[model samples]
Target: MERSHDGYDLFSPEFRADPNAHWAAMRQAGCPVAHSDKWGGSFMPVAYDDIRDIARDGARFSSRAIEVAGPLEAAGGLYLPPLTSDPPEHKPHRGVLMPYFLPARIAEFEPFVREKARKLAEELAERGGGDVVTDFAQHLTIAVLTKMLGVPPGEQFTDWMIRMIRVGPKDQAVRAEAIHEILGYLGGLLDEREVEPRDDLISYLAAADIEGEPLSRKHKIGAAFLVLIAGADTTWSAISASLWHLALHEEDRKRLVADPSLLDTTSEEFLRVYAPVSVARLATQDVELHGRSVAAGERVLLAFGAANRDPEVFEEPDKIMIDRKRNRHLTFGSGEHRCLGSNLARLELRITLEEWLRVMPDFRLVDPDGVTWSGGQTRGPERVDFEVVR
Candidate 1:
């Protein structure tokens, strides 16, 4: 039952409005490798097993071409070290930075995460209503990153982060420009650390010993750049999406408002339902996947959102189960290339949802018809409008 359509258009208004529906259609059509040139010829695997296997099997499916094009190649495009690099090289690079994102390490930052969320939540409460994405998610995203990465909350840095996250890689030139700006910003911080060390990510990366030597300036910039872009972008979608879910589902929101402890379960449920990222990988060699011949060098988009919804893996996959059992959806990815900052992401989401409910528990989306999602790579409401009475 191949799709009657030629291929999936990621940027199609229909797809952008509802990727889940697109994925469902693709899956139903029994098409696993739907290639599209919309973003420079990429193949998307819409099944749970295929996505999981491709992500973990880095040897066969190289992450060196994470995107269909070389938009951000200078900073380390597809070969974004650690993430873009395959094993042996990947392990050491990822290992050097693992200590910083360890569960215990991220857990220690709960107070900072909560305080940031609380402040933004209180302000939103005081205002009596506003765009959750702008008023709440954006501020908290920047705040958490600034504190965690040890970057100063400077206006320029904040502005860059917001722009990079909000306006991510729509055009090649703009994306390349954003990469340069991030490198320049982080490069300056690195130079400062060289003269006078500080207890921050830049300082650590510039000074830390990897494989008995400090990471080269280039590697430092690459690792830092990955974090800067990844940190500022992904989790905010999850945060806004959580609120979006609660906004529409009163039963779910009321349950959480009644007992905030359900946050851990509820957060996971929201993450599963609205997984934010759909990272791509380049095939290392010719391979057969789901009856299709995938030639080497082709980009494979791992539809994380689609994988989470596969009925094969989840019972009643479409509905929200706040307390889903044995839940192991790949929201943070899988294997060695799994998201480095997942622990922090979870904490941000949990704390953000908590603060939102505490302050604006009864908030609802002003108009479902007016909602629209941002579509290049990550997905979430571009502007989550809430009906709040000031």
Candidate 2:
């Protein structure tokens, strides 16, 4: 049962290894929308404008079920608001949570983010090398998430999140178990916050409401669950991919190292080149896209990564230009459902790179051929083994 897409197998190891190349081929072949029968049936819009339009047209593309495997409700309906909510519901959920992620509020988390990044980079430097994904990126992401949720730092949270976000999507049993565990965990925390509030997201959600009514327990847990799922792997993937890129490309890495001022552009370029997270949107009605018909209810994989790399939009799209000017890549996606955590994500990424380069500027891949990647809704290096040059 290969998840084939126009001669390419989306679920195959080869595609996961280098999806960008496959996508480039597809785009070059004049294929704007690549169809795949996997996950019941789905479409991937490769071009920038098409993806942008699809993302913006919420009426035609519902966000309620954002999985390539069809609707979110089919997967036990976890109800992660904002990300999973659509239209009117989306506005309120997004509004309530918006203040937390606003630039000013996100800046408040900078010291904490910087502290975690420094510690992780120092540990890796001390070890003279390590898997960037596990040892540094993933660890740093989970630590921040725990701090944001006001939960005690624990390895179990990391494990559960990894399973839920990465592994669970492809496995029903794992998905169900992980969802149950996460809901239960957050439910208890919500209960605690109800009586004795804290200065954390969970407490805010516990007390917060949509319109005038207080949010249901399920909604509270779902919001927190969104933070765990969205907050963990996506940033981890971006960070790991950035490190992986630098580990292989010495010249680019060296240039950034020589000029610390180039970090802002460098980070954005990395995000553009290695943009992780391709979201799914269900068609609300029959539509003709690039002369291809998409019936209502069919899932469309909004390939933002592919869109970012569209040559029509980005000159020398594949090349990672640290100082690429006017780089308005859609890595954060587009329209109303654009990533709520973009500001925070950018801060974490910049701080991660800044701190890592400060401590381990001379690091490279342990084995260029040995890096691993995971692909589906979101794609990134699963393991990026690096070795610091002494």
Q: Best candidate per TM-score, number?
A: 2
TM-score of each: 0.94, 0.96
Q: Give lDDT tens digits, candidate 2, residues 106-220.
A: 8999999999899889988888898999898888888888889998888887788667767766776887888898888888998899999999998899889777999887788
| CA-only RMSD, every prediction | 2.2, 2.4
Candidate 2 residue runs with Cα over 4 Å from true position? 1-8, 70-76
lDDT of each: 0.78, 0.84
Candidate 1 colliding pairs: none
The TM-score measured for candidate 1 stands at 0.94
lDDT, candidate 1, 1-390, per-residue tens: 384644667766787788888788777877766776655667777888889999999888887656533342332352356777887788998987788899998898899888888888888778777898878787777776777567766556546644554454456665656667878877888898889987888778888777688788888888877776676667888898889888888898888889887889888988899898888887789988877777887778897988999999999999888877657899888888999988889989988888778878887788877888876577787888887643
Give the least accurate 10-residue stretch of model 2, judged by summed lDDT: 1-10
